[model samples]
Target: MKPLADRIALVTGASRGIGRAIAVRLAQDGALVGIHYRAERDKAEQTLDDIRAAGGDGFLIAADLADPAGATQLSEALIAELRARRDPPQFDILVNNAGIDDRKTIEQVTEADFDRMLQINFKSPFFLIQKLLPVIADGGRIINISSMASRLSFPTMPVYAPTKAALSTLSRVLAAHLGPRGITVNAVLPGATSTDLNPLSDPARAAAVRDSVALGRIAGPEDIAPVVAFLASKEGGWITGETIEASGGQRL
Candidate 1:
């Protein structure tokens, strides 16, 4: 559709699954995408390949988003990398789709687990956005990948749920702060999707989760990618400061 023509987008954790899908979608929508990955260099290249095969322009980036330094890398230095490809250019869209989910609850949650979850899911995105704020041009779009856990209290995901909630709240505040500059900040809350992060890898556990969804199935990466691309496009220009859940009607 070329709706995002001439726009530039940077997506973190764009190695596989949801991040990979979003990278392809953004490129398909006409934005030159910078696909970011941590150690999944091959997967990132695959994502870039898909974009190229689809007649879209895309580039690849690698960074450990879980690292504290990674946050600053994505926020500031990545801009230089992107600009190196095109002069007088700045990113118009940012998708904070990078995160780690802690399946452990309070009883099982270790100090290290909680720290890692908080660092990647909440802390990194928070600081990264702040660092990149100056480089984001006017009317930019910032999309954070939150989880439906933010809207519901949980048993096995105490730490993870709170992390998403904090991000949701951050979006509310950032929306107002960025509004004056014509930028919109928002969050996407997904219920349950089929990705590598699945703790229930066993057949029985997977079946249970699938049956619980209203769609009678778990979602794939494709299911979530389009929504992200839409939000970053002109169509989503009016949507901001809110968490939009797209989880096949899970009974949270």
Candidate 2:
């Protein structure tokens, strides 16, 4: 049987990029996926189709994580769907992959911009866990998608990294708090990945990032998804409260 057979997974921001890859990977491992998207319903439908093509079952959910009401809407929709299936309204895996980033320096960053990033990147995940804890199955996995920026001190872009740092810290705390319930909370940090959010369009910049990595290449979404899939499996039960970097040995 597959590692996550008979399990249910919900991946936020699953319309594209790393979130989409993780959703597909979890589905491939035999989990019924809830593909959550904010505005890209078409892309989300495509993801669901891909899951079905891979012989997995999945559906789409819409929620703008930046908004508090969106979180409630998603939870209610998820509960209703689970009930329709005659299964308990419980999820076996929750991948907090939805986030936003700002490439602004301290001087350039405005309060609104900072709040927006924090809302989507940090606050959303915080409340998501608060609201979903009861529905999350015991022994379930809570995987937060973090970034290497939390560790690397880039010259500018100050605001984005701290939000990720907050998420990593949250993961550790949740891991400790939820351990008694058999829930494992962890974070995955990816570096210089080839995603829409972090494009490699500039040849010079791309080559510089590539040279910094031991693997000598930018990681694709495919490279990061399997690590998350592993974390959601039985083998990763003992691993919690850790931030695992799947960064192709970048900045090591």
Candidate models: Cα lDDT each:
0.86, 0.92
User: What ranges in model 2 sit over 4 Å off?
Assistant: none
Model 1 clash pairs are none
Q: TM-score of every model?
A: 0.94, 0.98
- What is the Cα-based lDDT of residue 112 in candidate 1? 88
* Predicted model with the maximum TM-score: 2
How would you encode candidate 2's per-residue C-alpha lDDT over 87-110 as one tens digit per residue?
667889999999887787799989
Q: What residue runs in model 1 are displaced by over 4 Å at the alpha carbon?
A: 199-201
Candidate 2 collision pairs? none
> What shift in Å separates residue 120 of candidate 1 from its native position after superposition?
0.4
lDDT of 2 at 210: 94
